[model samples]
Target: MSLLQRLIARPPPPRTAARVAVATELPGGDEVDVLWVRDPRARRLRLLVSERGARLTVPLRASQREAQQFLDVNLPWLAAQLARRAARDVRPAFGRGDPGPLPLRGQLRPLEWREARLLRIEERDGSIVIQAPPAASDAMVRRALRDFYIAQARRDVGRWLPAYMPGLPRAPRSVRFRPLSSLWGSLSPSDAVSLDLALVLGPPAAFEYVLVHELCHLIHPNHSRAFWREVELRCPQWRALRAWFRGDGLALKAEMKRLVGP
Candidate 1:
């Protein structure tokens, strides 16, 4: 063969498939859908378990057999995680009567509900009192309370940004509040900061830490050493605050979910 023909006839480099699907039976006879994804950036096999099921990400050179073996080794852990998620999915009811003490600004404040002509909320003598229309539905009352929480979070987080990062290059484009499921706060590409309204129900320190964490993201987009160093520079006690969020924060989220029903 000519030299040009020989060069052109060489076989193409081997490439792993982008994604493959498999199924595995759990200990309880439940079948879980496993997606095997070939990620060039993946350094090792990683398992992501969620309510949607588990996904196994492996390096491009890894095999399906290796993926199955990895899942087999971690079946117990996966089962436990699925069990925990199932427990969390069981929603609790929030009665119309006084909902008891609620976390506010790092303390538990008694929550009182009253019916009136107008919707009003007030913090009186370490208690949060809500007054709404006599005929308002539970959803309406919950919305009012949720809005109140958003207002509080907006005020506190707005005040904190300046105090925490006095040397920030520029003020954030905007600060928004919303009901977020799995995040405390996020810094958007448009330079806006979105905070979960539920954060107001956690400890004040935790809220502050979340604010600092997101603001640092404005500088360092990833969770690299530089980002953590910035976080430490702003909130030195951030680890303890994070621990509080991981422990007590779950209770706060559950309570919020119970009250809001989502």
Candidate 2:
């Protein structure tokens, strides 16, 4: 084919729309940025709020004016959600001269910074003490804090996993921890289990319930009656735990994210 014909036959690149964001003020005078997103798959206008801010998604068929009206109508709802977050937004600003009362293993512990030969953390007398160099940066402190939390979480899992192991079909190939946005715990197809690190910031009972729940998945992968029965066999108080999580889990996740940064 001629070069011109070949050029003509080539399909055009997909159109990409630039992201749009607008600022809106709350009733209490707090200004928030709302990102306007256009999605073809969205059937109607939707507003999503988080500690970061708000996002307004619009269907392809909707106009910007319609979207703005929808946002105005939902501003009150957003305000209420933000208020709830404010109550839970208690994680301290680290690295500053200010000491903290950070959440740890289901309770709030006072945070203290001290100068020591090594940059490390130690919990004693119901307080979290970080011994850092006189000139250590905030990022260094945050890393030490993150590592401290992970180590503590691993300690909990180690203590609890063996209890659930003998009854399971087999041991998990592996287990991992991270900041999961939507799930408390998950069992991979290979029988590996992954859990949210924020569980360490909640009640120990809730954390163990998640471990028990995932370990049972090795024998029954689906949430059928049999799986629930197995879960009950391992975790008798799971019903109460579920109710507690429904009330506090998401807020715990947001709190953890804020503490650790992103």
Candidate 3:
């Protein structure tokens, strides 16, 4: 290996001093402030951009020069992403007692709130009615609401998974759902499939499409051409659904975070 690379890879001696903060100038002349972190478990440098800001994590004892170089290379791409996020209109986050229609099942369903002895979420007359005590805490309401969303997501998975099982070599070891920041679905090395629970709030077709896509992974674990062909054969509308996500994925995730995430 090259001497510089070897120097960056080696662990620092005990009692080494912490490095200064890393910041770089964006093309528009604003400074992109980075939260630099050294992680012992990290295998390579990773950049995370979120509502909070940018975070750069590097392998323990990696040289600041290497980290800075990495950040420099990724700056343009980061700038573009930040620009997209900045340009999109910002929607206010959902909060308790807002009584606004919710983004549900590809439609904005009217949401009605009422006082009851206990918290409950029910669907009726093409809308959702939620009941809670006269003084329910926001945390309590959010928790109950998140549970409701999870149950709904599972119902869709239960309905669609059986149909896709026929031609596949075997069923997944397990199927699970949860909130994922950046992925719609993932297949673990153990063949378990986990999907983002937020999908239940979108169109049913998108939910079913994601289910089929993950089930296809039981046969081909990687995204080789053969794998995509299998996907197309199973779900003919896969491409359109993919395009749908490209257009609406960010908003959907943002909605999920607002409604259910802590």
For TM-score, the strongest prediction is 3
Worst 10 residues of 1 by lDDT: 3-12
What ranking of all candidate models by lDDT puts the best one first? 2, 3, 1
> Please, what is the TM-score per model?
0.69, 0.68, 0.70
lDDT of 3 by residue, 124-242 (tens): 89888889898888878878888888877887788887888898998899888887776789999898999988898899999888888888888887677888899999889999998
Report residue 240 deviation for candidate 1 (angstroms).
Answer: 3.3
State the weakest 10-residue window (summed lDDT) of model 2.
3-12
Q: Of the candidates numbered 1 and 3, which has the greater TM-score value?
A: 3
Off by over 4 Å in 2: 1-82, 86-93
Q: Across residues 192-250, which tens digit of lDDT does each residue of candidate 1 receive?
A: 99887668877788888888898888888877788989999999999998766644554
Name model 3 segments beyond 4 Å from true. Answer: 1-93
Model 1 lDDT at residue 155: 82
RMSD of each: 7.9, 9.1, 6.6
Worst 10 residues of 3 by lDDT: 12-21
- Total clashes for model 1: 0
Query: Considering every candidate listed, which one attains the maximal lDDT?
Result: 2
